[model samples]
Target: MRRLILLRHAKSDRPLGIVDLDRPLNDRGKRAAPQMGAYLAAEGLIPEAVVVSPAKRTRETWEAIQSALTGPEAEVVPSIYEAPEAALLSIVQTTPDTAGSLLMIGHNPGLQDLAMRLAGSGEKAGRKRLSLEFPTAAVVVLDFEGDAWSTVAAGTGRLERFVAPRDIKIGD
Candidate 1:
């Protein structure tokens, strides 16, 4: 089985004169990213390989997540930034076979749409929640019944869980 982790970029600041691609994560995002990383460590959802979008906010989110837990081999893929579902799927198909699990930190509604499109079944409540919105700093863990990433197709993955910042508890 191959596990895929889809993480939406955390909240970001819309600074005047800065382009959207260069916006940095806001304070809340800084907090949420680490908390989400903690959740991943607690749940043992670490990936063997991570593919990240090259946007500033997404990169900052990865840095914050890394501060909490570090293991996965990551790379910056320029195509991931603001890509649509089809484009994202193309990226997934090209994943190396050596990596058992893959993680992607990117934007939405590409991530959201991809997650929804790929998931055929899973936790009922989580599926319902996912259909609504993929909030910033949210994550969706999906399991596909294939050894090769190239074999994954639409409506083929089982949605293991859907988690968001609000669902996590940060210690005081």
Candidate 2:
């Protein structure tokens, strides 16, 4: 089976003077990013490969999470910065098969839309919550039946888990 972890970029500072891609993570994002990472590590859900958007917020989120993981290397996908659901799926479908567990840190509504489209079924509450809103720093885990990334397709994944920073206490 192949596991897909879709992580939306953490909360970011508003883009006033800075360009959208250059906006850094806000204080809440900085705290939530590490918390999410620790939660994943504690659950033994580490990914083999991480694909991230080139945006500063996404890159920073990956950096914060990297410390909690063992050896997952990250690749910057410029297209992910503004990609739609279809484009995002293309990137995932092209991932090397050797990467059994894959994590993608990017933006939305692409990430949110992708998760909604790919997930066939799972925990009813989780699916319902995901359908509402994919908040910043939310992590959605989906499990596909096949062993290869190339086999991934819409409505083929089973939602494994869904977590938002609010679901976790930072110091706990």
Candidate 3:
């Protein structure tokens, strides 16, 4: 089984002079990113490879998360920045087969759509929550039956987990 983790970029600060791609994560995002990382570690959901968007906030989110985890090869692909669902799908399909678990840190609409499209079966509650909105600093874990990443297609995955920063209780 192959696991795919889709993480939305954390909350960002929209500074007046900065372009959308250049926006940095806000204080809340800074806090949430690590919290999410800790949650991932606690749940034993480490990935073998990580794919990220080149945007500032997405990169920063990955950096914070990387601090809590170990030994995942990562790359920042420019195409993932504001990419459409089809473009994101293409990127995932081409991922090396050696990596059993793949994590992607990117922006919304695309990420949300990809998660919804790929998940054909899973817990009803998780799917219901996913349909509402994919919040910032949230993660959706999907398990695909096939071994090869190239064969992964829409409606072939089962939504294993859906976690958001709000769902995490850090100090507990």
Candidate 4:
């Protein structure tokens, strides 16, 4: 089995003079990012590889989680920034079959779209529960039956988990 974790970058500071791609994380994002990392660690969901957007906010979010991830080095892919679901799908398809799990950190609506597209029948209710609006620092875990990333398809993977900072706090 292979697991895919889709994580939307945390809330970003408004871009005034700064370029959209260069926008940094806001205070809430800063706090939520590490909390997310800790949650993943506590849940023992460390991924084999982490693929992230090169944008500043995404990079910062990945940095917050770096310490908690006991995996190979992360790769910052420029194409992931503002990429569509298809683009994200292509990236996943290209991942080596040897990598059993992957963590993708990027923006929405790509992330939200991807999650909905990959959700299985067992998780239909969870799929409905997912806001079309994917909030910052949200994470969606999908489990695929195939060992290869290329074999991942809609309804084939279960939505094993969906978590956000607010859910974490409520559970606490």
All candidates' lDDT scores? 0.91, 0.93, 0.93, 0.88
Model 3, CA-based lDDT: 0.93
Deviation in angstroms for 92 in model 3?
Answer: 0.9
Using TM-score as the measure, name the better of candidate 1 and candidate 3: 3
Residue pairs in collision within model 1: none
What TM-score would every model get versus the actual structure?
0.96, 0.97, 0.98, 0.95
Highest-scoring model, TM-score:
3
lDDT-based ranking:
3, 2, 1, 4
Ranking by TM-score: 3, 2, 1, 4
**RMSD, model 2, all Cα superposed?**
1.0
Q: Name the regions of candidate 2 deviating beyond 4 angstroms.
A: none
Per-residue lDDT tens digits for candidate 4, residues 141-165, read 9898977999987667788988888
TM-score of 1: 0.96
Predicted structure 2, TM vs. truth: 0.97
Give me candidate 4's TM-score against the actual structure.
Answer: 0.95
Candidate 1 per-residue lDDT, tens place, 1-172, comes to 9999999999999999999999999999988898999888888988889999999999999888885666775799999998999999999989998988899999998999999899999998888889899999999999999799999899999999999999888664
Give the per-residue lDDT of model 2 (tens digit) for 1-172.
9999999988999868899989999999998999899988988989998999999999999999899989568999998998999999999999999999999999999999999999998998998999899999999999999888988999999999999989987556
lDDT of 3 by residue, 1-172 (tens): 8999999999999999899999999999999999999988888889999999999999999999997788575798999999998999999999899999999999899999999999999999999999999999999999999889988899999999999999989769
Model 1, 141: alpha-carbon shift in Å? Answer: 0.1
| CA displacement after TM-score superposition, residue 102 of candidate 2 (Å) | 0.5
| Model 1 bad stretches (over 4 Å) | 170-172
lDDT for residue 163 in candidate 1, whole number 0-100:
93
